[model samples]
Target: MSSNKTNALSRRAFLRNSSLAGGGMIIGFNLLNSCKPKVVAEPTIDLASLDYNDFNAFIKIAENGAVTIFSPNPEIGQGVKTSMPMIIAEELDVAWKDVYVEQGILDTENYTRQVAGGSQSIRHGWDALRETGAKAKHMLVSAAAARWGVDPSECSVSEGVITNAAGETLGYGDVVNEAALLEVPEKVELKKPRDYKIMGKNAGNVDIDKITTGKPLFGLDYKTDGMVYAAVVRPPSFGHKLVSFDDSEARNMPGVIDVVTIGEKVRSLLAEDPSFSSKISSSDKVVVIAKTTWQAFKAKDAIKATWEEETPMESTEQHNKILTDLLDGSKFNTMRSDGNIKKAFAEADQVLERTYESPFLPHNCMEPMNFYANVTSEKVHLVGPIQTPAWKAGLVAKMLGREEKDILLEMTRMGGGFGRRLYGDFVIEAAEISQTINKPVKVVYTREDDMEDGIYRMAIKYRIKAGIKDGKVTAYHLKEAAVNDNMYGLIPNFFPAGAIENYQVDVASYKSNITTGAWRAPYTNFLAFAEQSFFDELAEMMEVDKIQLRLDLLDKVKPEDDERIQYSPDRMKEVIKMAVEKSGWGTKPSNVYQGFVNYYCHNTHVAEVADVEIENGSPVVKKITCVVDCGIVVNPLGAMNQIEGGVIDGVGHSMFGELAFEDGKPTANNFDRYRLIRMKEAPVVETYLMENEYSPTGLGEPTLPPAGGAVANALKAATGNRLYVQPFTKTPELLKVPEKEIIG
Candidate 1:
């Protein structure tokens, strides 16, 4: 039997009271227990007698010691499907050749949180799955050793066989029955880094063969019995409810099932908590569900639903007006205050003031929000791409007024999440539709519906002032206007909470005509962009290197001495020192222009030095040198790929991504007008991960925030012009300003 001990984790020491470790090291919302989960009396399965008849999901095993593993995470070109299995196989102690790989069932039991976003799959799955395989292997070894009347240590396991010192061997399949009868071990010994056979080694994605051969994998490629397509017609404006709809034309369309009106309605008569802000109703609705996606789309165009417009101007104009008003408003909550700010500003030799603005963005995952639900009076089955299946299944059961056990959630491989799939708004929508129709239905949102209806990364404006004395920086004041409540309402006190002296972060709300929700890095995605860029400008005025200025400021704000510091100054210095050394900070080619940015969030530290060159006044990033310390490196290759992808994604958003509105309707719906960074835009990234074996920090979002400002700073360096806006499509020539004459 595998040793049942809780404190024997070999990979890394489990933090007894770590907050992120509470939910079993959340990886893309999967709660993988550091200890093996107690298996409460499961039905026995005889491995030797078991037959592989059907090719379902992605894995299958035979009695002859052939094993197949499946890729559960959707392969949107990120190599998660292959890397995740390496962790499982390492502890299973099976030969790579004997293992067969398969994808997971679109159900919650087979795969918990199967959504691939936030770069969490590998980090979250590392410990839990290794324990699972170790437990299974221990059972097999115990069964064989007991039958041989030999000590378990005397029998070594290799390639699915247990061999004694005398060379007598028995295949794992021979003892499957006895192993199955044993209790599921609570704890199992995990392999150390030195002994890891597959984790650190290079194993390409398991689905590479299938993807190259054009095998059906994605939900777009998924088909079902009597399955029909579906499309929804949502309001053109945000918060729009259907007052009236005439579906006569829709009823006559070809392949039409039925035209249904989906608008906001009271889900429950229960009272909402007046003080609670993080509550989400399971049955919230303001949607349209129809038969075929094409038919629904066509019917939506034909059926005229009366909409009540919220505002007169567009979202951008309204947000800007709100920001301008906030600069004069007094709803400012004093996040932090050190000495007297009024006295500091009055005593300064000169006061420098600047306003920074960042726009709202969309979390455009490759797969549009979709869920397949088969609901009946007996039970409800849900299958689709979702980040948090356990949580989503609870809400789905609540919506259907059934037991939580009745709601079976199957997770399909997501095309991409980037934090979009975590909310599970689409899954609930699909379940409600299935309950209404009393049939197996899959609700699919068109790219337009998905973009326009979904929540957004809130837009923000920052007004900053710094005291400059004799060409030296002294005190700083930052006042911000936040359009939404905290993006991640759970962590309201993230940035500017207790960090920064004389800080006043006023969050003002001007209810917009658009819905807003979590984007990739939540609020930090934009806040870091704005704050890091402003710091760069401040450095230029002080005539000190930007990296040095930040380091000095960080050193002055000690964690113990000052409570207003959000990031650890020591950690920030570590990355900066490493990046500067590796990138040849002071020395560079005459043609290469480099910009530097470093920041910390999500329990991780990252620094980026992006190099660029201006050709014909357009910016072209050549290479990115990144330094990251995320505690531990789970899978070096997987972690590096996430950094590369995140950096590229951030660059794409800063350079050419935005959603424009006309009246209350969205303009950038499809890829034709909404641009994306392709293979050509991807920069060559050289990442250096800190080798200290601390518990892993977040890898998904750390590299993202710095990418935008680094590019912006590099552009300014090449042309001597500061570009202050989202999307460089605006003429770079407009940013040129002649240097002012200095008074002696």
Candidate 2:
């Protein structure tokens, strides 16, 4: 079991008489013991009584001038919880401090595309959010103008205060009631980029107070009266079957409420259901319910079950060998082929080929997998941290033979998602357990359970061969082999696709029983390192500058033909130049080893420079300078946090993150075996955002793919050894070392 000081419900030693949100409430959290929420009484805004006029779906204004903005996307520490609302508040011309942001539930009529994956929260919602806020502001201004009998355009608004040419001022709260009666304009003129005051400015994270003060915000901290705790035990191995289980000892344990086997229950419910994701394969599982969390866990440990292996007990050794064979063989599908690869390669001056390997990785979310479900015959209320609430609501309804309308899902702030909660199998387990026992159940997975039975990043191998002739690139061929599934999505149109005339991508995959899905930046995470490192090698082989070589290659792509390619060469060039100028690229100190990487992914262009030095025979990254062109940044502080987090996460994972499997089971189950980058190991990162009039793109995952590649390239410059494999510590010499002495 994990004990998060902020997220763990079991560790809550004291109760807080906080405020409650929605209806006549103040729109916040109530972390009290009672089933009824506690509210805070304020001076300016009455906590007991307040009348709010609903201007629209996204905005609500109180009589005392407090505005509530509903955040529609899941906040997975991706800054969407804060930035998404900033957009709405900006067009509404409200002060950032006066706004109270509330997490909206799954309402399909008011929201579409509520999932948090793909780093598309801000990108996809840009138009709708601006329109929503702009439309509301238009209505409010029209109301003020109608009272004065003046033209709406003549009345300018600032900081939620409208002032006419005659010097008459009216606060938004004064005319909110009249504004609610006016017809909302379908299309209101959005504020010009030059006039935006909220965007391109530093705004603090909205949940910073709750997070730093150890308040109840995450899914793990949610609790209510009459709620029972549950501990579940899944199959020990992948593709295993539950033959029988002995739960007599568990049912007799202290505080044990009930023991239910899920073999026939879940399978029969989802056997014919197409909505079932079937990723977790939880049908062959068992559940233990009890009065307390510790008691439930104790009883769960006492239970034992018999399992039959229905599939091969796969191993990492076998997977590596299979991937190698597949890469060498010819059974592959051509995803993208631009020019004649054979002719260019046959006429090249030199041919180089090297294979890069990566291991499976687990999400290892800090809070672990948990959910609260009250599955009654009439209504099913689910509260938890999930990225795809709408999609999972449908699946849960189908599994319980209920309608989607009967299921209500409330999203809590997630400790970390990184595409793990995108699959809500744990959420479904809570619903299943609650339906069986006819009680409100909150299921919590132990650290070992979360690590062992994890949906891992697919172990993949890539063989990239490039043909060079006369100091110019002639052909490029990339062959990939992965476990379970091949590459899908827009990776085919990524950078160098249009730059390289003779480009071909071939891929082959082997189906494995182990669950594998998106991890961080998905396929681009490791691919960035592999390809960027290869390009550095090519630059060295051709006696060309590393940064100059990329610019030269992009010179072949026209900046105007932006629609033909997924990434713009102009944007890529801008970030590269900015990184070079800011990092003092060519003018570094003689002792500093610098490596440069430029990448385009997630619809954003980013560049990174890693400064490294060998200390005690180990590579110590001193600092990293990052340049990003995600267009107009909504919140600079939040964007910086996202970039720094992504960089550190990328560097840490690349240096010492990997999951090994033996006999179809994880070899490492907890912190005792798994290695994570620590604070002392993290390097200082400086971020610079590209200023532009274009709308904001994604900063969550786009900046991650290049961090490791830059670090790896820097290590190559210092150690003269190119680290091809992930968890670079796998190298015998890259072991633990003492900290370097700091000169004050």
Candidate 3:
């Protein structure tokens, strides 16, 4: 399939020239640009003829009054498919029941900020989407006013109907034909928060019915005519390359098509281009293409492949030792510093120090990594789950020596992303296989292949130190060390970096062959665990409630004149107080011990409190209370679901999730080896949203950052023994308490 060919027309030009098919209006708005938010052009429409060829246009109103909003971002179960459309429908004055959502293909010329990572889907698209809807509404109102010879101001829209002061009304469909001919307004006024009829309301996801009915909506469910399947035999470890392969037996096997080996030439090209290489796994692998997925997998298993392992690989134990050594002796680079930390620590009344470690985590997305691609000398066609389609398109264009416009990239509903799909290695692999084989091919990564291929959450270690005097933290120091990349990339402005007076943040890095990429909240995933856990210890040291201690610190932050600090002290306190009140902070049942933590990230404020108890010698999470202030919350139902899912994910990872390695190969290849929190272990999650009129922020990641910390603090409160290591089950002393008490 080739990309839709059209004139080099701007969005305004397209809108002005567009014609409705069945008597309705189609509005196209200029999407956000790469450099800054700028209005590109004015929209226009024509009623003389019916033409529906432009793919850049987003909103469509049918003659039957059915509204279809094309969602511009990938939906990785974060509800962008619904929440984004809700924004447009609210501004367009349409009922939620009438809106249908469709995933728009990646078109950088028509859409800005198309990526779904960093929890930026709703945050980035909020204004642009609203404008698209508001413009459409304006045109419809203008058309009705002209037809009735009434002032446009006298006609108010409600649920796709225009009502005049005389109580006479016209359905949008009735005037849509004329509306299509009207010139697009230079500017349209958007509705205030109070006037919202669809946004912020608890509207169900548009795709929920299809998802519940087991319809094929995800990329794994996507199929096309004459598409073949392929599986790969990747290097057993990082920095290893395929040296030789015997595919005679595999070639003779049933349904085996071909065994294609990705050689050093392509690998070298990827290595030379860091921009393309960074977004994909650079591991060299041999692929087996066949008629079916099962056949491909079986043939891959049957092939005898040998790899040349050049670089030495380190085990998890060795890596941990390296981290410990770095923490002990490395000369760290200062990421941030304020006041004199040495002087404050020297004069402090008390000093508290602790070290925390978190192991590598795999995304373990339910669908694994899969993609479909058909590449020819002329163009490349790709359809799959991708968070950054435009970026992937650029990479593929560069690799194939073609322009990005020649590549047709589309996004399907993803079963789960959690930041894993942000990297488009699997998509690129599919394209490469299809290009080599000269056929449409779908590349599928089995659960084991997905787990061991290593685009994992980096293992991290943190050292925290604080000086307390007169019931106040006088000085603070945080030193972080991680494998491959620095934590600064994920969290450059970590909390308490500017919240404390005599604060200094030191960072160090150790290089490794293991591939690491963003996992959910990235550094905040572990930073929150370590930082909040340290805060809990600090609260105990000061003999104060955890919630109050955080509030006090937030209050202490003096407003900086610089724009670098993105957090507001007032906003932080709001969520903390809300969480405390909603969770009954100090008033839980006698058997329950509650742990509270508040954090700000991804432009969202979240405070979480986990209530736990020691039952049968293990920490039992009874319940969790979450308070989130993610701006206006475009869709309440979707927001709640995201928070709940994030909390459960955090809890699962903290309690029993880890990806260990031996000789640079992942030990946990599948669910059996990598433990995930089961349904029985999940806690009762109660979520509350703070009321606000501010623009929407992110909801996907902020809630998860504090989950691990809250649970860790709760475990400490329950057992009176602090667990500094992640996968709390790894701490033997904490687990031995139950058995020891039983034996005694």
Candidate 4:
């Protein structure tokens, strides 16, 4: 908030002298500002409306004539920190090397849809940015034409220069003063696919240099004058509410600024009484705001608060029982239904059924969730690792009861946001704290807070059944039982909402104390582990080649002809076939085994074949060959990077990563005990892209589902075992059931 920024230095000095004397000097570091366009006026162009002295939207214009575009989408290693800028430079006709890019402070008009989750950053910004760049180019060419008193058609723009047919040239910077006055063209021609100079060529990420050089661009690196640090004390168990708290001890501690109780209350008019907000109780413990992160962390452990305990809910075992019972009773939301499954089962020679379960997962990004907020009575200023700044700005305005224009959300590079940043809860929390304390505050969530307070990927239980006759597929039925509260509610709309014919997906959310939200691939990450594994079982019983069977099914059941499915079964087949040919389907190496799966989500299609070997009953993925088609790739290199990263992240979660909750408390709170896949565990991944002309879709999530399912299916082939449960471990075998085939 602006008021907080105005008051930060004074409040910090007051606290430092009166409260935190013996404490170490509160560091005040100044960070370099991001580059935004500078709007200037000339005789020919009108720059008054375009140039907002306060909103400088462009970056640098070097003496060599290079331009850098700044975007609000935080690059969190998914390559977006650079990929989005590539689109602008490509259209702007600038040398890739000349363009230096930076993540813009979160400002929606200058950088709309600053959120980076769902892999929608590039897809959403592609067309509009292309037009923006093309229009700018056109304006520059027109300015040159006017100077030469020639038709604009005789002038061409290339390499940051506007030149005439006679080869007379002028740098864009020279004409920008005049171009700023010219009317922007309504419709600038877009480059044809073949004529593209920057989109497809595997250009490396523009931000690679910054990241490799250890640049101070991450949220953790953000700082300001007299900025303080704060850590909220969340509930030990998620659901417990703060009934009362004694912060007297915390107040007396050195470096303790103030311990504030934070809780949400719906409008009194909307809710009967603001008794207890329906939202998850963010810990009611005192917030220890101090001059330093270390001091705040140290004082955090010493703070104490009283919680109103609620009835303990079901354990993992009990939750599993409830889901298993739902599947047994054939009770679910019924996502899809087609032919008479009962008659098909009765007519079949053999009916096979299997149940699968996936544990709750945490998105352990390399960095972590963090935000910096400077709030005051008049305005709010925020910067940090946020995916959707526009969305958060709206929420911040509402939460602060301030005009939306008063809030400035600055986007920074994120450590990671695998559907986690979708919830602006933490961002709003930081903004509110800064507003309450009236200071520039950086809120850092300890690894424990990040993991424990994480909106967990829901634990799901699935039951799959198929009718097989003479080893051929006849009929199929799927029953998926999981939480309906959060991400699962969005699955029906995003992924398999309409793709399957005769598919029955039933969803149920069990009331529990643990807070559940979104993870990487949402339900598909877990559901694919179940659905694709079941398909493998169906393949085994039918004595058919796995890849061929899936292809044949796609040919038979085109999604376009079926109203039950949302995706093109034809496109799904394309990727599956592509992966099969590339991975050498049906070929088994002496030392390695292969498994395959194809799934669609986030408007993208991915099919992967994983080669795995059993090492002491644990399936180790040695190599993964994936085929992805998310339509026209704006940047092939960047898209490939996302696919590769998502695959590795998916592999880690499926095979090893899990969050164990004991009485709603996380078991493995840190990376050491949590067991994430490190560099050593990373498999040799070969990724291929299917070319298509359709509008580009997302690449992040689609690549994830296949990694989990493919690895599981490969494990099935290597040992003739099916591990239905997730985090495939050695001790307990989840996929012990017999294999069955699909009946068409």
Top candidate (TM-score): 3
Minimum summed lDDT over a 10-residue window in model 2 is located at 9-18
Q: Write the per-residue lDDT of candidate 1 for residues 149-223, one digit (tens) a residue.
A: 888778888777789888999886577556656665666677777776666555655555655666655555555
For candidate 1, the per-residue lDDT at 374 reads: 81
Clashes of 3: 3
Worst 10 residues of 3 by lDDT: 1-10
Off by over 4 Å in 2: 1-56, 263-265, 268-278, 488-490, 559-564, 733-744
lDDT of 1 at 321: 80
lDDT, model 4, position 436: 74
lDDT of 3 by residue, 564-672 (tens): 5778788888888888889998887767778888888888998999998767766689888999998898878888889999999999998898888898799989988
1-744 per-residue lDDT for model 4 (tens digits): 000011122222433332222221111101111112332222222222222223323433332354646544676667765666666667778777666664556544434565666767677766766665665677778878999999999988777888898889998766666665565454668776676787777777665555677776678888888899998888777656667766677777788787775554223211442222222354444577988887788778877667766666446777777777766774456555666777778888877799877777777667777788998866788877776677677767766667888886666667777867766557867887787788899888888888877777777787778777666667677676774353363354323333233344456556566666667766577777787888788777777877677776666654555464667777887887788899987777554778888888877888899997655444468899999888888778777778888899889878787777777677878888897777988888899998877778888777887788888888776666778777886324543322321110
Writing each residue's lDDT as its tens digit, candidate 2 over 1-744 gives: 001122222101111212212111222211111112232211123323332211113565665666767777888999887888888878889887788777777765446688898788898888777766776788789989999999999999988899999999998878876775666564568889888888778877778888888788988888988999999888887778788889999999999989986645457656766334335774468889999889989999898889888988999999999999999999999988988999999999998888888899999999899999999877999999999999889888877889897987878999898988988888888988888888998999899888888888889988999999888998999989999768721277787888888999899999888887788887698899889999999888888999999999988886466455788888899999999999998788766788899998888999999998667656689999999999888988889999999999999998889898899899999999999999999999999999888878888998888998999898887767787899798874643332431210
Better of 1 and 3 by TM-score: 3
In model 3, the Cα lDDT at residue 284 comes to 64
| Per-candidate RMSD, Å | 8.1, 7.1, 4.1, 8.4
Global CA lDDT computed for model 2: 0.80
lDDT of each: 0.63, 0.80, 0.80, 0.67
> Looking at candidate 4, what is the lDDT of residue 735?
35
